[model samples]
Target: MSLTKIVPSKPIKLYCSIICPWAARTWIALTQANVEFEYIEIDLKNKPEWFLKEVNPGGKVPTLKYGDDYLIESAVTTEFVADLLPEAKLLPSDPFELAQSRLMADRFMEFVFPAFRKGLYQGDVAGLSAELFDGIEKFEPYLINAKPFFGGSDHPALAEILVAPFVSRLYLAIESGLVDSATSTKLATDPKYAYFNTWAKNLIASPGVVGTFDKTTNLEQIKERLAPK
Candidate 1:
């Protein structure tokens, strides 16, 4: 189903931080959709006082200031953009399909990511590798028919956009030896994950994902934060 793009008369402003995965969700969506909007980079460490006072009271990135209205939370902002720019085909128009796509994304965020963080930050490579493979396996069925993306779209949709950031981070961590090297090898060579690996490779290489991701900086930051004193 084709959706007509609704160009808002009011100016759109996105406040984001490059290192933040949540902020990356909105950034990737907007960039992929080719929507024109003002980009406001935020220093998460020392967020501007005005931002705290005038924008999101919680002082988080990925905040959307649309005209005089404000929107918070990554998922909300990403879906809102997808809705506003239907021409971008950011999401599926069919209700059931859209719901299914969202369900996949929700499951990844709720169950998969926490497991990833536990292994990455807590020095649990064995557990992390096992849990990651298990989590990744669950999503394989979703991509069983994917032609390199969710819903068989040529390009990414909302579901891919939502999870790209975390996937990028985790893959990077794995390649950098933060996770077990064997896990990365399995992702490439294992027949069990063939579908997922294909989709993940395409996602990481996609323009919206690669252009917005600063790999060198993020890896360094992760190393520094997780470095033992």
Candidate 2:
């Protein structure tokens, strides 16, 4: 299947919250693609009237406005930006590889995050380790041959763009003792996870991930969100 490229006739604008990992995914994609887009920060707690009325009634961050039209959903917008700028090579050129990248990213979004949330909010360390280890193990195979990134891309690709936010938070969570220290040790030192560690380290340091994510602020916001309400 040929990759379809959509170049916008009008300027692009993205409304996102800095603390939102979902929004971070789209931000990374557009930034990595080197697209010139207006960055409009949304106050998620109190959304603007027009944003609620016209942009997205659902009031979700990462709402992308391409001229007069709008697109919501982080995953949709992330991939859309990659597809829009084919020259960036954000998605793989090969069909199967492209599918694999999307599949891995989707898996992370579906299983990994929910597991992390369940563990964090419920304070289930054992359950957290078990679920996280399982999810990480599943992700291992994809990176076994990675040259520090999915599909051996020198820069972050679609998979990295999608999963980087959560992975970065996972590391921070571990360092902050929110996640099990043993789990972090194993991920860092265990030979079984060497490939994943390499890929993760590289992903964290990549320009796109680094540019869009602020470790300290995001960690604090996450803790605040997870605090007893």
Give candidate 1's TM-score.
Answer: 0.91
Give the residue spans of candidate 1 off by over 4 A. Answer: 1-8, 121-123
Error of 1 at 166 (Å): 0.7
Q: Which residue pairs of candidate 1 clash?
A: none
Worst 10 residues of 2 by lDDT: 1-10
TM-score, candidate number 2: 0.88
User: Number of backbone collisions per candidate, in order?
Assistant: 0, 0
User: What lDDT would each prediction earn against the true structure?
Assistant: 0.82, 0.79
Tens digits of per-residue lDDT for model 1, 1-229: 2233345667789999988899999999988887678889999889899999989889998999888999999999998989887878898878887888888888787656865676556755567787877887776655534787777778889998999998888888888887667888997899987877788889999989987999998888667655665
- Stretches > 4 Å off in candidate 2: 1-8, 120-126
Q: lDDT score, residue 65, model 2?
A: 93
